[model samples]
Target: MRRSGPVRALLAASAAAAVSAGLVVAGGGAAQAAPAFRAPMPAHVVAPYYETYAGGSPAALAAQSHNTYLTLAFLQTPAAGSCTATWNGDATTPVSKSVYGKDIAALQARGGNAIPSFGGYAADTTGTDIADSCTDVSSIASVYEGLVTTYGVTRIDLDVEADSLSNTAGIDRRNKAVAQVESWAHRTHRNVQFSYTLPSTTTGLGATGVALLQNAVANHARVDVVNIMTFDYYDGASHEMATDTETAAAGLINQLAALYPSEKPSHLWSRVGVTDMPGIDDFGPAETFTTADAATVEHWAAAKGINTLSFWALQRDNGSCVGTAGAGACSGVAQSDWYFSHTFEAFTHSKWTWGKGRSPWSEPKPAPRQAERGSRM
Candidate 1:
């Protein structure tokens, strides 16, 4: 969903740390049926990268099995070496502006939540590079903790990639700061959950990602999920996007096995998540992750007990025109509104209670199609 900037080349070029090769957490014993891992209720079909452009969908999203729209940014200021946060990209509009109060309230009304995502692709130039800029880990911890406390969120995801991932020093600071936040949350009994969103290939995480995960495991950083952005493979792009996703996940699973030798295959899979670019990706027309691809990947991820499933954005899952190129607002495909959301809804229902029962969302479906509005990748 973010700018990769020659991702495959980077992963290939960076020396793979002598750590585990690949993985995503799995859960359960063989006797139990392969049930869907309902990511904490009102948390399935999680969608990040939600900027102001996505205006209004809290009601629709909550009703359609969507939960937790990861508000785009918790940007940090550069000069002070301290921190300040914004919900959108605008530096002037601090999150305290209450720009998202209404949306957050609406989602909460539906028993959903808004999780804050930090350090995205633009972390390098935007002055939000927490990893590199926040050398004072405590200050950054306060920043993240403030946002989480404000939002009353139980989970926080760090979309670490691009420049954010490459800096070794920043990675160290990030892991430590995040662990500190976890410590605070535990003390306050907030039961906060931490996860990482890293770039990946069919084989495994790049050197930076591997190092981050290794550090988390080694430091005992209570990481709840390791979600990989399984798209924009570029040179590594494959015809079968779903199969490519499976291959990529398999590699990660094996690596996780080595990291947590004591955990079973099911536990490792349960801790794993895969974020896909469900349609034409940013690279161009050549790389397209389709609806059918979403179905196949959903089935496999569900069968394997993959913890969570998501895509680059929600603004794009429409039948709007995207021409021949990819557009960020509309998934470049001919389909009904929220088609992608419905497809991904497959993963939201049915709890995988470790050999227990499975249940589906009996909520209301979308209304009759209207003159829907949209833009593109």
Candidate 2:
């Protein structure tokens, strides 16, 4: 997702375990480190993307906010024409214990884990997305395998947006690499999952998003989740963000039915994910996602059994910049600190019921009348 602001300065990498014990490269960087303890992702989860560039301890934040899982955004090559993946594209923060290892271990100690993501807006716009920057398919797969061993994360998120979405060659290379990684994981008896985060229209994923998944199917890549960015339509229409999320997701479910004809509607719902941009998104007041929207979406997602519920960034789950659109550090709405986190975290163990004789995965109800659009918050 695009955070409309200047790129924050990269934080100095933390010093922890020695590289010799933390990671060892072999076979042209295709080797894995000794496995660490990792908890499997819950059947349902609420893992907000945590901005690593903006300095803070993820484990500490997770504890304070009562969040057990966080999608770390993002890891990419430090420059064009390089195959090495590092946090915030900084060479100092290589995929080793010297980076966020201790924090991840701490979170895992608390029965939580981190999901490292790749290719956010900046990496997609530049030619630094791992698959786009690196020509070697094996090397891309190696980077993914390295994350699983080094961090012991159960899930990896690929945030495909901006220019990266249109690069068909990059898309193919990515899916192919994912297939390779899954093959390796199976051989090693490792548990890992992949999720693609794509931008969506009100009705559903655009053609490119569908094509991306189609290619995944063609390549025999197992995509455990297809997460849609529910905010930022930018279509110049006044939006009730909560209602749009429902329609957009319903449209996506129908599309998935076409893609996976053998799966039941209930099973398909388990593969769907929704990500909201809290408060005001990049396009400003017309697309504000309010506190009420969070409650509505949480209940809807629980009832439908969606795989995940997340927002753009955990740091923005506050009222620091009310009325300011797309501020990186705040939600731009009046909400208590960590309100979104506390609200969304409930989905991890959510159990909501639909009315009698109604299947949870059946057709969505018509959106409540367009929320009274009065003053722009």
Candidate 3:
């Protein structure tokens, strides 16, 4: 998720309070109920992110847009050294229903669920990313487990980018924690999965992103998804948005093939996910994702059998701020409300197969390109 303005100096004086019997204490003496458990996300999904800090009701938006899943962004520590993780780095919004429990439950009741994402651009740069702020591997794992038990979510997205990508210690600690949490999940019979969302070039992940995944492999952490931000090339070149998305994803699959050499081509495709910014991304008009691009990507994703098809946000699904760069409330293009959501919701259907396939928009599986080794994507 994109963050703007000055980073706040918020502080949480103590570590995260322990989860007590699936409940966490909230402000005003309210004991929020734990969200009811929901089935794991389908093998293929169209879960556009809902910006939690943007003050929108996730459930209401899902219903309005007819989307079954949303990746909530993001959870972070309140202070630089705090071990606790909270929504938008606010101490009051810990892993509890009060923060978004009701919304998640409501979504689940409608046969939908939410995926809690951690470490966006702001959290990654501020030293407030949970693993960066907390040194203890156990504590970081506990925080992750708390999120799962509190919300009953099946997947967690670690939006590892910015400075978090280079923090070697933090990266190691995070992967260790992820391994620990996966072990706990296996023992508890919980369906927990982790995804590493990293920035990418027009081609694929750079050395830092590859290093992060390499460490995850080293620590025996299972990464279910390698979702890349497909927009925001910011490389001073005009982009055919949908084509770049396909190439970038193809490039990622190539990289994943090298990373998990034992996996088959189809399996690596199943582990792939691409996140497109709906309209104009942070890089302005040179990288606009039009409604046509959405349809093109959707069809391509369905054909390729990618694991996930998501955009930067559901909030920016409209054209309320045309020609703007990275508008939080609206996509900077002229379109009907929720057009992207409606277009992508087709991806939620389970009919797609993760087998060797082809599409009119699909890029041929490319060999790992040595020339495509750079940081910014």
Candidate 4:
């Protein structure tokens, strides 16, 4: 169930993590161990998305092999305002593949946890995003709440990109839906959190993305994370892909710190996340998230206390497939399978604990601040 507000819900989640392991909760899957409450605290998270095989069984990439949490990708609501979660497209009919209800159950049963990501670049042929198809925002939120309740998940990731980003009206609709989902979580005594997945520029969130965050803040949506899709910068080879990503992240962190002026720098960064395509992006050969660049991005996240680190898809985590914008099968790199994930996973381990304020990789803890303000509830 939900709480009074984001602060109460977040605090409750953190407390749940402290409880013994066998404690179970019910939501989008079978009754299972509640997904740990690990936000607002330091976590070495290497969460990646699953797309190529998202509609099929999830055993191919082995989500647990290198990531602490895997992101179930593109839980799109179909066109014509159906609001039913589907994979990567606009279809009048339902996709036969079992998704949130079954696939999620299977993964969690195997000791894996994931956050459902809504929307993606694969919007409909006309550039309409999944979130935009719905005129009834509350209905959209109801679907999201149903997933959280069924899976016992800790969070819902709104991957707002493509046409949706520019749709200011749609952004407001999304913000309202998210706020309602958080409210439902409060009422249900479930601790479901929220995050936004937006595209970024080298310097940070663009005006559109910033507006999305602003709208959420204005709507009182408790966004626990602001995940930046850090690839696809088409600036004519002007900036190194990885370094530009850091620049983008640094800017976003500063923007967030300014927005929630009370939040500590470290805490603000902890709410920031980065996810780049593993290799070439859809923008042709403009840039590629090369294998070597993986360390730079993940290490930067570690040193800066970035909360979540993710790549595009698990299917592309291999080195065998090269060239082409990362669609599926491989990341178009020159390394072995799971190389990027393995490197990014390096940031995660038992060294850091929740609410510790800092990771071993980060500089020694800053003067203690109001830990409650860390969540900026």
- Evaluate model 4: give its TM-score: 0.77
Candidate closer to the true structure by TM-score (higher is better), 1 or 2: 2
Q: What's model 3's overall lDDT?
A: 0.79
User: When superposed on Cα atoms, how far off is each prediction in RMSD?
Assistant: 14.4, 11.7, 10.6, 10.4
Cα lDDT computed for each candidate against the true fold: 0.60, 0.79, 0.79, 0.63
Per-candidate clashes, comma-separated: 25, 0, 2, 22
Q: Give lDDT tens digits, candidate 1, residues 1-377.
A: 35322211112211121012111111111111211111232333455445333343333333432443544444545432446545444565555415454445445544455666776666654546666766777777777776554545556778787777767777777788777877765444344566788888878787778888888876667667788888787774445678878988998888888888988888888778888776778766666788788888878877887766777765556656555345655677776766776776667664653432211211122233333221000
Q: Please provide, for model 3 over 170-285, each residue's C-alpha lDDT reduced to its tens digit, 9 standing for 90 to 100.
A: 99999999998888766554567788899998898989999999999999998988999998888999999999999988889888888999888877888888999989899899
**Against the hidden reference, what TM-scores do the models get?**
0.77, 0.85, 0.86, 0.77
**Best first by lDDT, ranked:** 2, 3, 4, 1
lDDT by residue (tens digit), candidate 2, 295-345: 999989988988889998887887877999988878899999889998887
Kindly report which residue stretches of model 3 are placed more than 4 angstroms away from their true locations once superposed: 4-37, 354-377
